[model samples]
Target: MITDPELDGEWDTAERAEPAEPLAPRERAAAAAARPWLWALGGVVVASAVWAGGLYALGDRLAAPTVAYRATKNLCADFKAQSLSGITGDLRKRPVNKEVSHPAVDAAACVMNNVPDSPGDFYVYVNTELHKKADPATEFDVPSVDDLANVGDLRTEEVPDLGERAVMTSWAGEQGLNLKVLDGGAVFNLRVFATTFSEKGGRPATDSNAVQAAMVQDVRELMAALRK
Candidate 1:
């Protein structure tokens, strides 16, 4: 029995306090290992943020190419396709044409139904796009087929001395040609289709070689006309 009440309370408090249990060896080791991983994860997050910020700052500069192409509404009247006139006859007074101008892109298209009176089917199409916002080089040469046009057997050939890159496409048993040219940020496409069943030889109105040559020649003139 203690005489002092204060001394007795102190003893009681000491008895009530149990020593805290130490963590298991495995738990301690796991905690130690996780500390480094947590730090690494934090570092990766910070680095990712910095990289994203940098990319956002350089987005426009990286995506846009240096080009001097201007949008024109007179693309239809500008291109005459004179070289093709011999095969498809003279151009009509009115050809279907469209033009669109936007901050990101400018587009112009012309479709001429040549030799309407004396031909079975004849068409000449020209389209030009000025990309003022993004580069079109990546997907330019990608292979694509038009199922609706029966273009499964379409073949492509490279044309030199035209632009940055040029490609001509033609299909088997088809008297037509598709030519695409890429110059800086400008994309140009020219297509010609002619099918006339002649009674004399039972052949198409235009041969493959003739169509190709005429398309190439007319496309050069078309490009020059648009540039002017």
Candidate 2:
């Protein structure tokens, strides 16, 4: 019989081809032992993904609301500090006022003094901040009055029914009272400094009870006006 060259080559190649080697008994057993662990690892990954997704969804739903407080150019106009003045005296003809409007925060500060052209011994400092991209509640708990003022026998107290949370810190002498409130993303800080100087010396003229009450009331009214 005569065979074509191409057909002869094809038959030779087919005869030399070998089958794939099967897994060894030891290798098969190892793979079998690893299967459960691999499956457990995959299950853990999926569970973690689901848990992370749930937290992300919950965070979105519970995130703080956008700042609704409308900060005015003149906080002095928004809050007259009448309650403070009721004890100190009539506020000077013109209370010092400053305003800042920015994308990140809207801020204003007002210094009301009874003495004209001077920092009155008895005066109230008011400041407000409406944060657009941050929540003041996170860092509001850190007390600030001690750092800023001469705090002698400092006393800190919690204020209820005012805002999301509020705190008032009082000191014996020059540092009278510091009231800070966090409502949504808005931060309201009011400080009352009262003192009287005579030939002998100077002593704190502030009535903690009365000043604390007035500060709370003024803060409430100020919060209301800003919300409006």
Using TM-score as the measure, which candidate wins?
A: 2
| 1-228 per-residue lDDT for model 2 (tens digits) | 778867776445545558878999999999899999999999999999999999998784456548878878889888877677676666646788999988888899988877767666677789999888667777887767454555456777899998999988877652478899998789999988776532112333556677788889989999998895
* Per-model TM against the reference: 0.66, 0.74
* Candidate 1 regions with alpha-carbon error over 4 angstroms: 1-61, 117-120, 143-151, 197-206
The C-alpha local distance difference test score for the whole of candidate 1 amounts to: 0.75
Summarize candidate 1's per-residue lDDT along 1-228 as a digit string, tens digits.
546766566445535667878889998899898999999999999999999999999886677776656677777787787877666666655677899988878999988875445443667888898887788776687654542365466778899888889998876555567889998688888887666423223333556778778778888887776673
RMSD (CA, angstroms), candidate 2: 15.6
The local lDDT score (0 to 100) that residue 162 gets in candidate 1 is: 88
Q: How many residue pairs clash in each candidate?
A: 0, 0
lDDT of 1 at 1: 55
16: Cα error in model 1, Å: 64
